[model samples]
Target chain A: MTKLIRLRFMFAIFCLFVSHNSQAQTKEFYLTLENHVFTPSELKIPANKKVKLIIFNKDKVAEEFDSFDLNREKVLFPKRKSTIFIGPLKPGNYEYFGEYYPNSARGVIIVEVNYVN
Target chain B: MLINTVILFIKDLLPIFVLLCLVSTCITPNRVPHEKLVYVCFSSVVGIFAKFYYLPMMGELFDGMGIEVIKTLELVLVYFCLLIGCSSLLTQNMIAAHQSNLTIVGLVIFTVINASEFIIFLDSYLANSQSIRDVVAGLSIGLGICLSFSALLYFSLHWFIKKEFFTLLYVVWALFLSGQISQVVNLLQQVDIIKSSGALWDSTKLVKDSSEYGHLLKTLFGYEAGPSLEFIMLYTASLLLFIVTFFIKSSKKQHYDIDRV
Candidate 1:
């Protein structure tokens, strides 16, 4: 019985690895944080498609890129680039902000069915 | 700024409070473990300070993925410790002597992980000479909310225990750990160690993940407004693993008792 349980546990882990390696290529988008504000405060991406977000924090201090709408969060060290993958999302607006500078560093990810590039 | 600080406080600190309440109410209800509490507090302070200082240096490693990698390691350690602790508790109907040490280790690791982010935030604000008053006020309000919620949750769990609702309590505890371990997927994906997928569903209209209640639920039960397929699979698997392990150990213990009789 213990052997059976161990085998099942291994199978589950194997499935996770398969899923991880089976992903197709995703589209890429860029956003920059400068003076505590996100550039292009609105970003557009295609609906129902996975995309990568490359965020650059240009300030001298760190910032955390937080988006409750997208269920993503990552810390962006100053002058360093960070990456986040989001969405095969429904067409709508998803808001994001800098956790450290929430009042000033805010942006929205606008997913559109007809958005190009 | 005050509101932001308050929100940040809740986001970073609520998990620690919830974990403390869960441990106290579920694991050791009758007597307060003052020594364990002191150890947790001391270790958390030391861990947070060490991380705050070394984090910037760590970020410079792994091509800037160092922090994520380190945080993932810390989380993984917490997960294993929890499993061992839970297994022991289930088999013995109490924490075995040495297993109590593992439980304390898990609590210390968890407290450190949850508190380090807030410490970093506070340090950054203080370094920039940001409004101390705002930070203080926000912290006070955040503390009050966390204490009140934790107190309510503690009493509720105690009531459940008195009512002999052990199954429900165990299920909730398992869910909490699974929810936490599932976060490892998100962290790994953030650092590109694991592939990220599209969310399985969206429930933002039902509960905005940014709202106060959303944060509360997220901390308490690992609630996500939108969860990816990977997240769901991992969550389910971990939850089942915990439940199965507990039951298996429980049955073996029962057999041993019968043999002794």
Candidate 2:
């Protein structure tokens, strides 16, 4: 009976730690597009960790989010929200551009170890 | 604006011109019959119309995977048709009459892809009307470049064919096809449709893919600054498959000829 109670206590502590770790790990970032330009031309993110990116197209025209570095491309319709998951990446810079507006719309992601924490 | 527009025009149209030049050189005559040409043109127009009308619907299909999936399918189909058309020429083991139709199918699919870009560019320009003149001038220049470059390709390929450099032509053709096949891998990776093991090497500093020469090389042979392991493997595999199949078919034909003799 004593052993069973000890095991339950340990399990409860383990669950709490896991929940806290998950909450600490996921980071959210936002980007906005307007007039064929990214609001933040560059974004900084933590290396070796998955990130949730939410992009808002504030423009009247659609834009394609293309990153040859990250190997990701998605169409962002006008006045729509796009959610993308990026990384667990190595520390480096990943450049992206708006395929439709390659010249004016460009940005980079600078990934560094422990940049956020 | 004019320069930018011109560059964009060439960038968008060059693929079409290159494909046409290569395909035309693969066969004997430089021109197809008028009726067949009209049919192919009509099909391309239909493709453009279909793309414009269905863009929104296609975007939302398959939970936002519709476009990638559809484009990948179209590209794969085009590659196969090209393989059949070109391989038949090299091996002479298939019905020559049907080869023309296969090449036409490849042409139509490629036109659809290339024309969609034009449609997209036009729509963008129409949305912002200030750059109309720049766009028009740029398009004209782009057309000029395309025509000249394609003519160069046509003449060179013809010269090679005339010289009976079948081996050289076959090797180049195999590499070109492999490059195209590699693009299917790229597209699949782009949309997260497939995962790559990451880049194997970075050659961007040595040869940036966006440079003029880089673009030319890319079109002629799928060149990438940083290529993934999957890409290298796929390119080699596809090239080997084409070369081996060509030789196998040719040997079979020779054996048949010997028996008849």
Candidate 3:
């Protein structure tokens, strides 16, 4: 009985930790991919802040959003949206591209020190 | 388009080839049956098809974090399978059957994960139908490069084994597995399943992580240009786990042999 109570307590604590870590509410940004191109080609996000990036692929074919600079990769399905969290980064230009259409689908995430949200 | 296809193929398929080379160096022919190869091929095909159809829907789960979660789980499983296989290799007492089974399972899972990404690219290209020639040429070139690399690595590892550089080989194996497992940190962080941290250091100027060299290093060593603290810790822990397990099992087997002698 005591052991069971202790197990339950631990489980509750674990759940609390997970929820707390995942719930910090970061600023969200949206990018749309159409005709194998990322719109705004240059997105400016606040420097040194972790932010949510929601990318929607409006094309009929799937595209992989790959960024060596950001250390991120995601397969954006056709007409579906995908979310990736990036940054808390130093101010710089991080280039990203669609893996399947790199020549045409390219963009850069500009992290600025003076960007207003 | 042709260059992009070549890069994509290398980025996605190189890891599978590297893994095959590593495992081949570790196992003897009699230890792994011929039938297991067939099973791995069948499983990979089925797994890729399943992932291709189901992954997009899975992405919708957990508030758009499903793919990350699934990949993380798959990576963790692959790590354990490698652990068991490594242990079996180090210890004489472990049953051969278990080792072969674990190897097949690990290969199947890793192949499915890597090959499915390539399949996605191929699917898109087929849909477009405009760049079929380029795609075919790129695939042929990629296949040649991958095969050449795998052959070179396999022979080099065998040379190391012949030279009795067991410790170096063991360390390389451990680092490779750890590096693969460390990817889970990025996946979890992407979905906010784990707390995100800033990169400990940046080496993008030295070696871009998307370049051909980067893909090769990442496949062989799990090289990350801007790994976070969490990634480092996980990597070190996994490396230690593999090393410790190998040594402990090795010592036990040595003791058993001495007793029998």
Q: CA RMSD for every model?
A: 3.6, 9.3, 2.8
Model 2, native contacts kept: 0.02
Candidate 3 structure quality by residue, lDDT tens digits, A32-60: 99999999899999998888999999999
TM-score of chain A of each: 0.83, 0.77, 0.81
Better of 1 and 2 by TM-score: 1
Residue range B29-94, candidate 2, lDDT tens digits: 643455777888899899988886687578677655577678778877887887777775565343
- What's model 3's interface RMSD, roughly to a tenth of an angstrom? 2.1
- The per-model lDDT (C-alpha) reads 0.80, 0.75, 0.85
User: Which one is best on lDDT?
Assistant: 3
Tell me which of candidates 1 and 3 scores higher on DockQ: 3
Candidate 2 on A12-49: residue-level lDDT in tens?
Answer: 86453221324245688899999999979989999877
Residue B110's lDDT in candidate 3: 94
Better of 1 and 3 by lDDT: 3
| Clashes by residue pair, model 2 | none
Per-residue lDDT for A66 in model 2?
Answer: 75
The DockQ of predicted model 2 stands at 0.08
Candidate 1 lDDT over residue span A37-116, tens digit each:
99989999999877778888898888888987777788777788887777667899989998988889999999999997
Where does candidate 3 stray beyond 4 Å? A1-24, B92-95
Better of 2 and 3 by TM-score: 3
